[model samples]
Target chain A: MKGGLFTSGYGPILIVVVALAVLPFGFSANTTLNFLGFVLIVTLAAQGWNLLAGYGGQFSFGHAAFFGMGAYGIALAQVRFGLNPWLALPLAIALGALTGTILGYLSFRARLRGSYFALVTLAFAEVFRILANASTFTGGAAGVLIPLRIDAANFQFADKRSFYWLALSFVAFVLLLTHWIARSRFGAYLVAVRENEDAARALGVDALAVKLKAITLSGGITAAAGCLYAQKFLYIDANLAFGPWISVEALLAPIIGGIGTVFGPLAGAVLLLGLGEITKTFFTWLLGGAVPGIDLVVFGVLLILCVAFAPRGVLGVLRRILPAFRGGRA
Target chain B: MGVRARAILSHGSMMLKFDIFLSALANGLLTGAVYALIALGLTLIYGVLHIINFAHGATLTLAMFAVFVAHQAFGLDPYIAVFILTPLFFVLGYALQRAVITPASHGDDGNILLVTLGISIIIENALLAIFRSDTRSIDVPYGFSVMEVGPLFLSTPKVIAFVATLAVAGLLWLLLARSDTGKAIRAVAKEKTGAALCGIDVAHIYAVTFGIGTACLAIAACLLMPTFLVNPRVGNAFVLVAFTIVVLGGMGSIGGALAGGLIIGVVESLSGLYFGESLGQIGIFLIFLVVLLFRPTGLFGAKA
Candidate 1:
């Protein structure tokens, strides 16, 4: 509660934030915009997860459920019912919260903690994946394809810059909210619960309510990321929407970048996804032909190495390299 | 399914429903045996280490692929393959516990989970790179045959899986309940500090337990080769089953695993009739969530 509004001491982060906002203007190149969009959209989901796992102390293995819901919420709204994608965005996010509320309530009330709690979420996501695959409305295995109309209301744009801006704005909003949560009184209660639920409850923390609230907020943010993903790809499939890989990425970003850090998720996303692309291209060229997911193997090795060597993440490493870059607690 | 059936249908219909139930029960028992073996391996590791081996399913997947390769190269039958790979997987599991899991285990619960998750990612993606994601299966001689016993039908491979599952579980139970090393392992699982105080080699027990767990997977993998297709993503499929069984059976309980596996197997088989294939998996996961929330210690778990 004693921390400032920004984790980067406000000044450096301010410049970074400003640069990110105006980035598309100067560097509207497709590659830059594409990469930014991916990172920013993924950042939304990763930050949500970071808030929950890093701060709230709930290690969820099922964030893909909310991500899938967000993707389906917007996809089904616009394609199945002809609703505007813009209008559907909030609906998607709300649905994410609703799903989170239900699962969170059940799990918290039943006293599911640690890996069991995580497994429950994973099971829910798996269930959703199968339901999506079996249903006729989701287009079954082939997936739902949005009309290629270049309309603002549809959230489709001819230039990738608009997509980048939309993603940046969403990520910025979530980051600020997370910033507030991290410094607020409620945020303290969250950390307390994460550190020791029984003791937190002994001090009258209302453990169930605190956990549920964190999960709901996290779910809503992740769902919005899902919607962004759907809009960017213009395709929604069972696998793409509810795949375990999405959940893995959501957790991996924060863990690798710096779990519980405000900028960790963003940093992790950039490092993992960004490095993933570079290594993939480099390895593919070296080996000749598509190496077929060697980059993922690299990622796995990297994750293990990071966990073993730098449990605190990249921000932790940065802090070690330059002691001046330290303040917030993880 | 309802008493209304008595009023609206003939005795023949009632008998037919009974027959269907019996058939499902038989099939469930057979399938549940295999599920028990797989889930038991997961539970054993968790019991001793207090860490969720997210990569357990991936290791099982690795064993399945090993069977596939053994078949392709040497034409080794899955039955014989199980015996051959058991020692090999035991060594692999032992080395992994020593090198990767041991360090991460001391870090934190999340670290261990994430580390295993990383291992899974590496194993799965490596398989994808090498195998190209095509589904592979073992063609056993009696792979598809079914035996009928008083209106109950059982698949041949499934029966073999059931028999082999029981044998392995029994052998493991004996080792844990009777042997000195098994007592050492149980003591470590129950109280790591106390076990160490008693001069037990806790780290060595951890490795041995992990080894036995992976050895169990080797057996289950070969048993499943004739029934299920092997793919890089097969871990995703079976991990859910193992999670459900482990939760329902109570982690670290051998008999409970068999019982829980049977229950889930029956539920899945019966539900498959109504929900079809993929939805059947959804049903299993739903049960998993329910058990996880309502009874996190599982039915047989008594706060151990």
Candidate 2:
């Protein structure tokens, strides 16, 4: 609709990024920094998921395929061939995009959509997880650990706050890109395909190609999250890298925050992780003992409640109430 | 010769290999019966509701835990526990759909998916919180008992499960074919709005279908407890395998699910026999992908 960044919706995103970028400075505690770093990484992954599922209408339950690709690709590049993490990062993201292309190609060729598409993607992820677990190329069940080198060149920072900044920068860039996509022709085409594939095809939208591009971009973004994850934790096994947990996390954040919005993933990630910590602490106090799954239980209940009462997610709710508070139109 | 010597001798003989192959086939069929039982509920739910219930696995895990608790706390036999838990779960399943899933999802497919996923998360984690993730199994008197058939010996529990599965399947078929409730369910599944126009209660039918599906899980759990372990996450493995079976049998086809389960079981067994144990698990998922890509309608499913 518009050429310039401000008209295309990047202005507000820039403000949000600037605000988030300064968060680590206010909290020197490693716990807070670590929490914020994780939130940023999850936000990036959720944004990737939202790009396809939220915007493009392709609900992939197997995003772990791309996430694991980025994770293992970068890890192997470093651990197996001794490459710098910085160089390996792009390679890993590319590998993730390539995987998205391949997975998208086969499933779309079959014209699988909706639940069928979701099931197939899930099966594909399980295949990857099984292969990774059984094969030595991924270090088998024992997993891989990156050598600790506390230098900026290695993408490993001596201070945790620096890593938080690095993660925040990546998330900020992705948020801008997402805003741009939302304003572009391709995004319109993607949404059109999502709304009604046959109708979109009738309008000559090339639904398959649009979906393919969306998935590729989505995969690359999610994989960037995976790459950062490997660099942060310095260790990943098949279960950790290719697990259903990350897939769930990637989907849950955007759904909770506000699907199909640029800032939804970020807001959703912060709320979800923050909710998790609060729930865990509250449950432990109430129960007089630490319970491991209380937080997840709360997440599940919250997810259901969100779907039932606030299907549009937190941002949607905020938008509804904000106008009332300001005595203005929504 | 002793059983070990016979096994060693059989390893060198073609006849013995054939015998082993037959035995593996038999084992697969037996295991497939339980798998079919698991998929039976999933396919039924899909057939009527037209939504993939992501909570299927967590429900199974819950049923298995029911069996475990019954056996541990009450000294109830798994078979007896099945009769008790089946009705209990029927009510639970009905309440879940009518009270939670229906009202919350507002009948949107995407919302239904997320709601079920959330329900799964709640159930699975609740089990984890309560049980502490310990893998538990019940010891039946027939646990180690085997029955000799020709040149092979089959586990008693497995044979019993096979018989029980067939009986349950037959009962389910008869109920659907003859009962008024079955007619209503079929009518609703065939055309929801039309069925509603015809004065059939679509919501009630949906709940009933879900109840039956969940009841099947109770039966499957009871049968499996004698041979399988129960843990917070144990149902997830079955859930995937059941999805494969439901797809293979064609969604919404009861008979097809049964046949698909047996076929998957044999394929899994043969592949495990040939390939290493861990990698052999890939055979099921690969088949799932191939079928989804090539034959999404499945062997007996109506064309989408």
Candidate 3:
């Protein structure tokens, strides 16, 4: 907010934003938009993880709990309470933040750190999954389905491009928020906490406050993605909402792209999900039968290579190679 | 009270309920003993490497599949497959440590977690590619034999699994306490620099320690084959409980892992009976959360 909108810090972002805005006109079928929409939504979730794990110094292994909360929040709202989907968006994200607050409050208040925090978050997600599977309010394991009334008020769209544009807007909002937060005073405090908690506390940083805020924001963002996911699929289930695979997907993108950077999750989600689809299609064509989760193996190998060869990530490697691009604070 | 909560409270009020509780207890102990073996290896690996190997679950699953494949393809008994797989896995672990894990062990904890997790994904998916996703089970002739204990009956597979686990644990204990290589591994885990000063091959020891850790899973795989089915993702069912046991028993304590295993076993059994099968995970997680928050060092952790 302090700097000019087209400052050096946002050169690449401006290009991407302009391109995405004009992208729909180039393609008539909405195929590219739908694919990119999926990428953007997942990128949104990945950014949330980047904020918490990469910047906030809290590694949450259960972000799916909030993603699920967002999904279930909207599904339950529309199905159980007969609320409009438009009215449900904010509530879903709020529910996500609320979930984050609970997870953060319990773990952070206990002063749990590192693996302890990770494990607790994982446990929390597991519990949520079980509850979703068991509780009638959640429709049990059968999951909740949205009513097939495609009204604009209900956030349903006649054209796939409308949903794509909406998803793009959400992605842009998160990217801008993350850009501002990455340079804010609180963001500095978060970086300090992540670099060294004891040292950060010694330097008068409120470690707990920073972590709580980061986690809350992270949860809300992830939940927002869940809402979009539900909208795109028009259905929600326990596995889709609260599965470990969701958590893994959210985290994997940011880690592979360039953690802690605003564009990292965006690039990562594209690379991972985009590449995954391409490879799956190619392999499926080559072998004539689906290789049964071949994409996971490829992605797994990529993850291993990234950690081993580029532990700092593709952005980190790029920054190292181009000193002029290096803008302080990893 | 909620139906689930009430079910939890009334685990054993009637004759049938009492009988069920007793049977669950028996089942828990037998499974818990085997769980002890799994936890022991995990704890030992973490103790030495100072890294929680995320690929361990995948490795366990791979070992289980090895036995399953050997049995299905060649008609070898599960117990006999143990002799073949144990050494095979050790070599694999050793090679993996030297080639893959060692390079990534550059002081950053997150890298290890991700790399091992990546390995786990690779292993799981590779298995899925090969075997499809269908569950595979082995048939043992004596697997169903039940022994009478007054009014209680214990199945042969469970008893054999329990005895085998205890025997393995006793052997591991003696090895760690008495053998020179085992002591060297312990010394390295306790004090890496000090062990190096005493002329210990640090890297070699690390690799061997990893091998031993993986070898333990081989035993677990074979022993578990009689009672459980194997699938690409079967390791997930047991891995979380194994992790909880490792944390509960203190990071590297053998006795603590054993105790933790038994506790989890009972918890799983009782919770499964009380709360329909799926909700039992909630109980395990709650216990893990409590243990984590209250005592970060764990029950049997050495005083820091």
Candidate 4:
């Protein structure tokens, strides 16, 4: 059963990965590559959000806290401690997991859930943002800048394609991990807890333990995306790292794609970013200038429309329209 | 200097410090009055609808912008604008809940959260698109006037805000306690299915509650215009603190919110005095976290 579980999803997973991997070859334009890389990084963060929210039913409004920790972790390690970028990446990811563990422990220990939990997470993010902004350890408000050196050894690639490939590989790894979790017993336990915590606890499941593990895993994956962001941008600031925008994007992707599905984040990320591009371009043309906030306004409308029309997401819409397209949930 | 002289100097300084503390407390109370007003709307909506209106801040921002536009374009006094904007905003809020949020959310908690969030994003950005990102504040005639009482000087606008807030709260309390609509809202809040079974229009009540809450913001904006600056993101500062106040005051308790806002305001002021302005913001979040963790019901709230 274990072997079959592991093997069954690999075919579709491999096909998706291979298709994404070869996309740079078809459209090697820097703009296209950059867009894809950004989308893939966002997909990683969304996947992290999906793990806890979609599967575990623990909705965090502050995934940015973990994402920012990863970003600051990488930046501080490289710039402040003089650690190698490659070593910094793993440490950064670990730092995010630790943050998640600490926050999850405190919040869950108090039995806070639902909107209370969501608000608390948001408060935590705000606290972190304020601290990071005020402390000299984070270079105050001026922010930290990693000295750029274009080299494969330093994890800084010369070509956009290399960075795109790196991002794709990380996303692919997380996708597989998600696929595994979807099939594993652990996943079943998580779903059970999400469906009804009291019932699951009655059936001998340690709901707290399952939640803690889910948050920890979620944090680490999101931090990896943050780590990648720092590597890509070579800069870090309090707002950029711990902002509500990243948190919004993280949740928006999984929600728009299809919550609880492995590829939902990926599909949602692609569609969201594509929609963003379309809105920006269209709005710019309509307004006769580049204006801020229009894309986000459109996103807000889309979010409401999605909730109203397609509560299950784009995947759900597709399933409804194409009844025979049921290939066993993405 | 002699020992007696030195001791006298120290005593004088201690007296001065006490005076400073008193003033800070007074200032906190005045600022908190406005905060309570902002949070009143939030608590009302939450009590009835059970959804955290993420767009609360944006609506506040929009109202502030309305006040600004009315003043800039029509040369209207903010005090006068309040009467006009409040009713207008009530209608806006009603339509928003009835036409947009209620229909969009479909009564799911998660969907409601997303829809509100989406509404916030749209409203905030729409303001940004129209007003640009620059902070704007009106120069009212009484902007810098001060009221002095027992070694404390309070800004005239803030003092007025405090008095007006109390009046609004009293009015709201009366409305909730006396009116049939208020009884329906209270009934709906306590038991939605029961209220529905009793032939009360739950949707209309929900929209009415939302409208009342948003109307509170219009009043808050008018009161705040003379003293506070309005930017695209300015409402965020109040929104977070308002949430903290709502939780601290007890989720649905009107009196608790008022008291909580005042307490949080004083705490913020004292923290800012010692910890510097930027770091002082942490005090609010800390209180928020603590209240949420330890006393989710708040002081005046009935146990869930």
lDDT of each: 0.87, 0.90, 0.84, 0.90
- Give stretches of model 1 more than 4 Å off: A1-8, A327-330, B1-21, B146-153
Shift in Å, residue B81, candidate 2 = 0.5
lDDT of 1 by residue, B96-161 (tens): 988897786465887788888899999999999999889888787778887756555578899889
Of 1 and 2, the candidate ranking higher by DockQ = 2
Chain A TM-score values for every predicted structure, listed in order: 0.95, 0.95, 0.94, 0.97
Answer with 2 or 3, whichever has the higher DockQ.
2
Rank by TM-score, highest first. Answer: 2, 4, 3, 1
Residue A10, candidate 3: how far off, in angstroms? 3.0
Q: Please write out the lDDT profile of model 3 over residues B30-85, one tens digit for every residue.
A: 98988888888888888888778778888999999999889889999988988999
Candidate 4 local lDDT, B1-304, one digit each (tens):
9543453466577777886788788888899889999999999999899889989999999999999999999999999999999999999999999999988888889788889889998999988887889988998899988876755667889999999999999999999999999899999999999999999999999999999999999999999999989999998899999999999998877888899889888888888888888867988988888888888888666543
Can you give the lDDT of residue A51 in candidate 1? Answer: 89
Choose the strongest candidate by TM-score: 2
Q: Per-residue error at B58 for model 3, in Å?
A: 1.7
DockQ of each: 0.66, 0.85, 0.61, 0.77
Tell me the tens digit of each residue's lDDT in model 4 across A150-232.
Answer: 99989899999899989989999998898889778889899999999999999999999999999999999999999999999
Report the Cα RMSD per candidate. Answer: 4.3, 2.1, 4.6, 3.6
Candidate 1 yields a Cα-based lDDT of 0.87
lDDT of 3 by residue, A68-165 (tens): 99999988998999888899999999999988987898889888876667778877887788889889999998898887877677798888788888
- Local lDDT at A187 for model 2: 89
Off by over 4 Å in 4: A1-7, A328-330, B1-14
Please tell me what DockQ candidate 4 reaches: 0.77
Worst 10 residues of 1 chain B by lDDT: B2-11
Residue A180's lDDT within candidate 3 is 79
lDDT of 2 by residue, B33-131 (tens): 999999999999998899899999999999999999999999999989988999999999999999999999998898888899999999999999999
